[model samples]
Target chain A: MPPATVPDATHWRDVQLHVVTGKGGTGKSTVAAALALALASTGRSVLLCEVEGRQGIARMFDVDPLPYEERQIAKGLPATPGATAPDGSPRGPAGTVHALHIDAESALLDYLAMYYRLGRAGRALDKFGVIEFATTIAPGVRDVLLTGKVFEAAKPGRRGKGARQYDAVVLDAPPTGRITQFLNVSDELAGLAKVGPIKSQADLMMTLFRSSRTAVHFVTVLEEMPVQETADGIADLRRTGLPVGGVVVNLTRPDELDAEDLAQVIAGTADPAALAGDLAAAGLEGSPDDLGALAEHLLAQGRDHAERRALEDSQRALVAGYDVPTYELPRLAGGVDLGGLYELAAHLRRQGMA
Target chain B: MTVSSTDPGSAAARSATHRRSSHRVGPLAGTEGPAPYLDLDALLDDRGTGIVVCCGSGGVGKTTTAAALAMRAAERGRKVVVLTIDPARRLAQSMGIEELDNTPRPVTGLDTSAGGSLDAMMLDMKSTFDEVVESQASPEKARAILENPFYVALSSSFAGTQEYMAMEKLGQIHRQAEADGTYDLIVVDTPPSRSALDFLDAPERLSSFLDGRFIKLLLAPAKGPARVMSMGFGLITNALTKVLGAQVLTDLQTFVAAFDTVFGGFQQRAQQTYSLLQDSRTAFVVVAAPERDALREAAYFVERLADDRMPLAGLVVNRAHPHPPVELSAEEALAAAQRLERRRDDAGLHDPELTEGLLRLHADHVRITEREAALRARFAATHPEVPTAVVPALASDVHDLDGLRRVGELLAPG
Candidate 1:
């Protein structure tokens, strides 16, 4: 069955901006890329922005290092009559995916130029070191500049010839430990800038965030720590009144045991005699001792599997309790590659996370 | 800033224990010569090694490894202290404490009869920063800087502050060891970041930010003369006003001024800490999971540490899948499983499905075990000079002293 959250379809699709975050190491960048791909796969153009200077998006797309300018990495296909995708997401003709690696220093300069029309002074501002100090070192404004870039991209496109509208803007934001404080721009700038064009910009950003136009999606694994962070991160977003979107649990292992076997193993009551007999019938034909050893090994493995499922269930319950929509991406036995990334995007599309 | 005598030129450490595994060859044969495996127990037990810093990206179990190492060191009789920069409460709970503050707390239930003791503390990055500020600055100035909105924001959750403060805290603990012999060894769990090098670079970044010409330029509006500077400052400030507004600029200037007096001290302290880390007595243990991305990150850590001249102890590959004991090949097992399933009704088998399930699980285990082995071999091939240890994935989440003890034993198993 489709996840309860995605049934409305438009619940996530209608929003123009989707900010993706999670605990560190949850593949947040990969998920953001996949979401952008999935959104654009339906013929809807999307922009993927990464703020951390890691150049992760470049590596993800297997392209040369991405500069500050927006570059088209992938184009989506519109849905075909019966097109089968490698990752299993339904596919057709779609729009393109353009990415921007937002450097805080230049982005701050961009913001300044946008408002004050500073050209030579902009380059001079960078030289004089105010840009680096404020954009890189200054607290609050650094994040504002990063998220501000996303907000600027996600705005309703300008009205004129060559006006390009984005179906969604996906931000590979800071990890959970700092995301809330990073995204809470109004509160941050409100305290610092009581009244100015900067404060007005902050106000505009917060207005967009609190509105339905923005949704923050968290990427996580079923592991306890990342799961806890996922729950906590969502609560932080909610506290700031930023829209909390679906939870994308990454690198999930498929359950090997069904409910019946799991219950038996959890209770530690699986029949050893039966297991040995079955092994013998299958041509092992070993002594009882060897058979018993085999049975014990199988039981231990089954027990571990059962215990993990139980823990995963509790972790899933934690996310489920948050009342946010969630999507699970299966663990790729072979590590993620360009093809695997598309597979994941197809998976996300099938699940309607786009 | 005092430069250590050792800083001139140190080549990449060829200290890796496992030499070329000539027996195996593939795409992963890393370009290298042989090196020694890391002796974690010996490193912990050695009096010469004063500190063990576990550095890695998140979800790699660095905190657990640090705790286990500290526990082993204490049990081995080296009054040890572990400082965890991780925000997770697992360390406190595992040590049987409700909360771990900036100050080290003695852990109970350790086998101290051998004369070793373990003390654990969670690094409250902000509190640690405040403590440093409070100790460094006069009372009035400390208060003003602490309450400043800019300072509050920067100190609390600022990006680089935690790593900088961790370095400071390490220096503090090391100094404590020097003074009254509070603890001889410190095992630090570095903060989780997009890049582990941040731990090595944050203090320098912070120091540079404080001492950089940009701050002087910002102060030019108030500190420098107006005749030559006013025109340029005026244009910049005019532009800054439109972006940051005049009020925000004033708040920033106020924070920098209040924080100015300590710039020299901050720079000196950061340098001192860097020198201390580079000292031979300090050991850097890079931890990673047995995955491609994690291994790539581990390589980055290893290279950066070498460039910085931090004494490299070795690499710890955590949560690796152990090769299964059964001799049955996955194909044979599957074939047997299919037979059992086909004969479920014909044969008097008690639970044919269970046996088939067992066979399938075994196949998966074998496959996963081979994958993990390949990944490890790949890493070994690439950085054969980095001594390495592989730890099997534990049966459960490590949440208590006993669990940590188990990890400690596995880390350097007999």
Candidate 2:
């Protein structure tokens, strides 16, 4: 077979936004932060936005909560103090990155205030429990608001004609189970609202979400349920004609042994007496029972290794079933820090996703 | 929180011992013949038992279990209400409700012909928060808090806010049920998020968020010297104000000021609720599937309940796959595969490939059985006293009341 063509990280540079979502605990925020850093490394100004006020990306970047305003959390290139650009822009570095956590309810209120010209009506209605009812009592409204905030951040200048503020935006969205509902909220509201302003806004948001300029990455662990959910989510997204970018399998175990070698080891490691002699030769002292225990331990270790490989294989098969590019991130031994996220981002870049 | 007098481990052990003794009574018990189901009547006889908490990891049918348990209580002539926190609308559909919010709604189709009634409610987190503020604060204060931009933002957008509000809703329901002398039982179906423990911690977290020292310090009026000391802070806050285009900080300040008075009462009530969960009437049914990860989470939950002295009623493993018995040796199975491969040319003697595949499948099933047995053994070692019931995997999704009844039948002892 001929060598396959692999898309490089530069392919992602032209894409205006990336939305990362998966099952809860699947490291969606980490992947979003990493993708932002990776894109920033290529000299693009990136805005990493998180809906739901999770503040998870802040922890990933080792910073406090990124306020609603775009604040520069890191500079991809080295910065020189008081540096100025030829275009009269205050330029300290080539590649700059900003982060923000969207306060969804506030964003929704703002949207309502701006679009409906509610003025004091918004505040009054909010006090009358309408805001709470809209956000919490309704099933999909909050998700719609959250997605609307993210969609706004993605195309910041689209609402009002202005210069595009950020080159790209990375959104850490809700988990996979609710993501389709969140993204399709515009469609949901269109049926409910008909020819209203909200319906038109939902229409525009839906267009942006389904456009080629947007990409949705599903993050998952190399476990059965999450992988199954990922597969289901991908199918659901494809059914809705949404852009399913790729799968990022988080916290995968390292490949220490190949199948053939593992089989050989398992087949050859059955003799307790021989194992005892080998251990004795290796400078370990033990009696027959202790040596027997050691042999059983080795067998158990082999079984665990086999099981992990089987799990990885099943996960890969599930991802392959969706025919999406799959990226495997190794499990970090310790805490997930900013540096580790950047490394993962670099890997994504190398895999053709900035 | 009130701790139960009966030791959970001893209770589990007694149940297991009873099962074993019952098995010795006749072959009927041992052979899975129809027998009298486990009596729930004597198990939950306490009139003071106000709440039943069903907690476990996600995708373990915790909501269904809570609903069914509440239904069982209601069917036994006890007024019961089930509070579910599933974001999905399935709970409302399950309870035959067209809509559900933070407030309790009487569950229809409860077979009132039998003189038993059940009520079901789904927690709407934001509405619950609104109710909390509205009920606790004066009308003007409530309006201020509810209308404040920051309050609206935090109540709706915060990650653990739903869990916090769910607890608040539970407290409200529990109090109302007590006041009305209507509900004899309140079953709470916790959110299935991995951090389901938030249900226990939400009250404290919410109270602290309402009256935390850091928030107080931030909200304090900037004096001449204090302003000088907080120069960088003033710059940041100013930038924040400009970007937000509203007095976000002031809004938060006003809301917190209004919330301050009720903060202690909220914490005390939460503590009391937590204690209520520990009471004997509040049976903790730890639900899980046969999957390793779900089992692991269940084990952790069981351990947490045990350490906290909470009343653990029993264990319910949902969707456990049943494996076929092993009748052939590996060598014999291999021989059969070979024979089947040779007989592929023969006319339809259950195609050799099919036979071989079945044999291989049977072997795999045996392995799965061993793995499940190992898991059960480990659980028994840790929680030997707790009686465990396994519900076999259903052929289809439980979509309606009939499906729920089927599931209930499977869960009930026979």
Candidate 3:
């Protein structure tokens, strides 16, 4: 096994952009939200953005659907005891999380208006279906515009007034299968627009994507396919010379049985009579047959649990082979509401992911 | 956000547990249920059902479901072909089609006692597109369109290309099946898109982009028949050139002009496939996990299918956490576990640690089952007309043929 480069207090402290990608249904949006909250400190304005126009962040925070504009969605979680400054003082108050549902057409309009000041011409382009073609049908302009918006948010400075400068930007990018091509915009645009503003914009985003200030984290569940995708995704990111970040193992199940009990359950040596006697001794009202049935039920569930635990262990071992700092967020019993989001943020901060 | 108490002793949780246990509402609780069952065997046995399209959100086991259905159907004496858009490496190997070169190869090691056969293939999107181009255009014209920079970009990495190519391949396979009688059943696994319905919409999206007035404007100069419309078209072209660079515009115009001749055929084929999907012979099986987002996507797909007047077969809720077939309430289990803990603390005799752990695990299992049941019930309430088949959560991932067969058994159990 490779020696994993574990994240420390200073590891991601200086990152200006955090890109979170994962297999679908791995709770990638939730992890990105938690990471944004983790990175948001006092006086730090973290921008959480979704480029797929899914309005996932808005739904996650239980707010109205966010427009293309960046709006403050929620306040960050209060700094945990683990989140201390260099001198061991408690971190300041929680910061703010602003979210943007960045759609390609609006971003393209914004880009053209900003770069060429072609207000009427841009509207004409829309009338001609050029905006639709560019954003949806064109090869790579949609990604270019999407990442360009994120780049604008994460860039260091601004020249105009009212331009919001974010301390950190968290993007809920596309799925792992398309993530490398999504982020490596330069290569995506190389064949089509080699000398255009879009090409340069893609190149600029590529620079930030490959820099130390950026980290692309992956969220995955402890399943075979998701882990396999994460492994392949990380390798793809590394091969493209992009900055790879830590892995956040989301929705992890807690072990209910210890090793001996699990082994006995798996081996079918669990004493059902003892279990029934224990149930009867615990003051449960049941007949002998009922007790036997209940004991069998519990043993069946235990065996399933044991098997799942074995699978999860193997998957975790596979994740460990990636040699990156890995953090785990437990599966919330109830669904992830806002409070649960804060709980996950606290877990990330405790793991020094901020 | 209010921090709702997750404590087992909380009044809300206890009451909820009582409600669930009293009603026995779960995937496996067949004694008290009106939840509809999707008869996979009947669907597979039907000779009129020529195509089955499996679609849903990603990570919801759509590919596995499609593969299992094909395997089961083929082993039951039907000639089956499964066109999986993207499958895991082990799953492809299990089907004996490790080479995903976009051809349907026969899967060996099937039971064949029923005189059944299974052929599996993975979609290679680029090759599929190339085949379409080669079939549509003359050799030199196809070479021009294929080697064009814009065509390369559109075919290789365009947003809707995979979905489009999947549709194209489906159409090709269906035509060949009809002509040669090679296979009677084709099970299609849709591409894993942000929206599960992208495959259904991809053919239209691509054809519209190709047939739109914008493409006409770009091809006006190349076709040399737009002398009357040049003034307005030149302004748009100049704007496009200023924005996308002159060389980029020229390449696009050239590609569009070359592709224009072939796109009419493409559009007609896409139309035929769309009609094929809406035909009575095609059945749409919406697959989802018992999670909220996946169910929500399933709901959207169900509504969309209804809107499009497509034949809705049923829903397959995969990886459902079904509680053990016992009348144990979570509240009662927790109370018993707490009583055991207290007795152990007081006397230290009868060390009921294992019993306590079992009770807690059972309580946890009950809670999970209740939550999943609620999610499924919510979906059912919205779309009660749709039949559903809930597959229990397997202890391990399905990789090999045996595992897939286990899933098939669970899917349509007697």
Candidate 4:
């Protein structure tokens, strides 16, 4: 139950689609990007998709605003040859990576064209604001369209013969609060359509979602609220029979005090006169009262750290109770530049996540 | 303590001292230049200030800040109601209530020395929407609308429903307060949308969806002027019928017809609430942490508030890491700790790890403080006019009233 323990990553080679979601401000997008990079570096070509239109990918890469089109965003270091799955899917080799910002409106336009083959009628609908209706006013339709794009990208031979296949597709999905509704969108549409092509597509999507090939990972911090949310989110995913993946505990701060120091803080057993003597020896000149203040300050901070570590222990236990692999990323104190993103990817790789 | 406006000095110097003094009063000293002091005490204590909206991206302690503000305002003798959209159950329980619902409930164990009281409610969006419809539409129409499949979906799980309901609930409380003075201050915690503007745009979006031409055309087949239902509409309806089928269309029209009667009331009420948001008495407190994305969102909120001419009280940078009170550089701390480590390893010094750990901890503290100061400086440089108040990171997550009181003290240290 110790925090920042990067457990063995049960390797997601068999999974095709990875949806990363968590509480807001839990670094969901960053975790998704790192997972994508890790998957790609291990020799599996990958696609990174963002559906909420946050432009988070572009910002993380420090690139110009990406248009609503699929394009190459990054390249991974070549992977050495690796094991193959039982299905004869070659496991890991050096791969290429691409990104797509899934625009709901554009997806709707494409969806209508694909299904109805309505060239002029599509334009008429767009003019008459039916496109807007489908994109906006229609409650569950936009989510379906956004999700449909991911399905096409993940499906083999989706772009016709000789089309590039993605070993993994990473979706930086909505936060945990809305994730169940977002992924269960097919069920939502089923309630509406009853028996149409919409229902059939939804059924297909739900099947894909619940299968072993799909996994939704929860990213969270060790704080009480996010940990509580992660536990709740995992339960919801399990309740609906969605494939739940491992937990990515993001932004864990490094330990600043060892066990003895923590014990002293917790037990209130530090000798004041001895601390004053040590301070004088260390060239920190202070009267006995001044030394007392310094010792008190450090002890207070130590006690605070002790409390946080204890709380984090309970949170880690809660996550462990779910019986899934858990990986941790330390709080990057160097301002989270592109280098930090790679550092996180390397951590995931070391943990065998990819 | 209030950053003296009477200081006759160079503008920059006055502002610098102002910034420094505010930081020293609370937790740490910031080297960042003078952004105006937010004066949270003044903002909360003023009788004219009625509404304080806390908004940011998710997980930035917006709820904690709102709850603390409510407590502070109440203790300051202004009756307060804090409406949080979906707080964790434990948090509600910590406030001495099993759960918060649509109705405001009195919170016990307050100081109440100033004859002030605190009321808290969690915004139940679906129930609020139902209440809006029940109050605005006739009973039969309301019942019909509530039961409609489309209406049920929209009211419960739609994208814009929560935001619209937040506005609706705010308007409801404001109206009630203005009439009978149930509370003088209404503190709101907004939805955790990716963009803060969602709270501002949701009502407009719902209005557009209802009043849009497609809806008019859908309803036209059943009830419309012959001229309005031209040959063009007939062609569009023919295509729509093939696409959506007749039953779905009928459901939508029936939902819209019953919904349309109260749709006007919603739009007008939303407009009124939007105006209230823009009023001088309303203050937008954009909350963020010392992080890149959160501050980026905060900047967007600042620009949006300005664009809409909303009165921005200031920015509240929560969870700020404060530097230690004593002056010690990271280099000095690290050097001292290394010497102690050498002594411990070579000469068997007493409690070596503890002493060394203390120094190292101090070093880490200094480094984080420097980094956060730099980040704050960057934010200050971008939007210098926006006043700011900083709250240092607490040791534990805030739960009960005592935790909130500590937060309130830091929010505006007397």
DockQ (C-alpha based) per candidate is 0.44, 0.03, 0.60, 0.43
**Which parts of model 4 are misplaced by more than 4 Å?**
A1-11, A77-93, A160-163, A270-299, B1-32, B96-100, B225-246, B331-344
Complex DockQ, candidate 4: 0.43
**Which residue pairs in model 3 clash with each other?**
none
Q: Name the runs in model 2 displaced over 4 angstroms.
A: A1-174, A177-214, A217-354, B1-49, B87-91, B108-115, B222-246, B325-339, B351-354
Relative to the unseen true structure, what is the C-alpha lDDT of residue B38 in candidate 4, on a scale of 0 to 100? 71
Instruction: Please give, for residues A19-136, the per-residue lDDT of candidate 4 as tens digits.
Output: 9999988899999998888887777789999998889999987777777677777776555466553335666555667888998889877776777776776777888888898787
Interface RMSD of 2: 16.7
How far does residue B375 in candidate 3 sit from its true spot (Å)?
1.1
Q: Over the stretch B352-395, how does candidate 1's per-residue lDDT look in tens digits?
A: 87778877776566555555566666676677778776778885
Return whichever of 1 and 4 wins on TM-score.
4
Q: Candidate 2's residue-wise lDDT over A1-354, tens digit each?
A: 101234444444457878898875567777888778867766678888887654776766778777766678886633356644333456545577888787756776767765666555556445444455445433355667777776776775656533247888888887887678678866555423445455567788889889888888899876656777888888889899888887887766545445553464446544545544443333344676775565454444444445656656766676766766667676543325666776687676556565
Worst-scoring 10-residue span by lDDT in model 1 chain B? B1-10
Q: For each candidate, what TM-score against the reference? A: 0.89, 0.56, 0.94, 0.91
lDDT per model vs. reference: 0.78, 0.63, 0.84, 0.80
Better of 1 and 3 by DockQ: 3
Model 4 superposed RMSD (Cα): 5.2
Query: Regarding lDDT, does 2 or 4 come out ahead?
Result: 4
Ranking by TM-score: 3, 4, 1, 2
Native-contact recovery for every candidate?
Answer: 0.55, 0.00, 0.64, 0.41
**Which stretches of candidate 3 lie above 4 Å from their native place?**
A1-6, A41-43, A80-83, A86-89, A281-283, B1-34, B225-228, B342-351
Per-residue alpha-carbon lDDT of model 3 for A97-172, expressed as tens digits? Answer: 9999999999989888888887677787888888888889889888889999889888988645588888999999
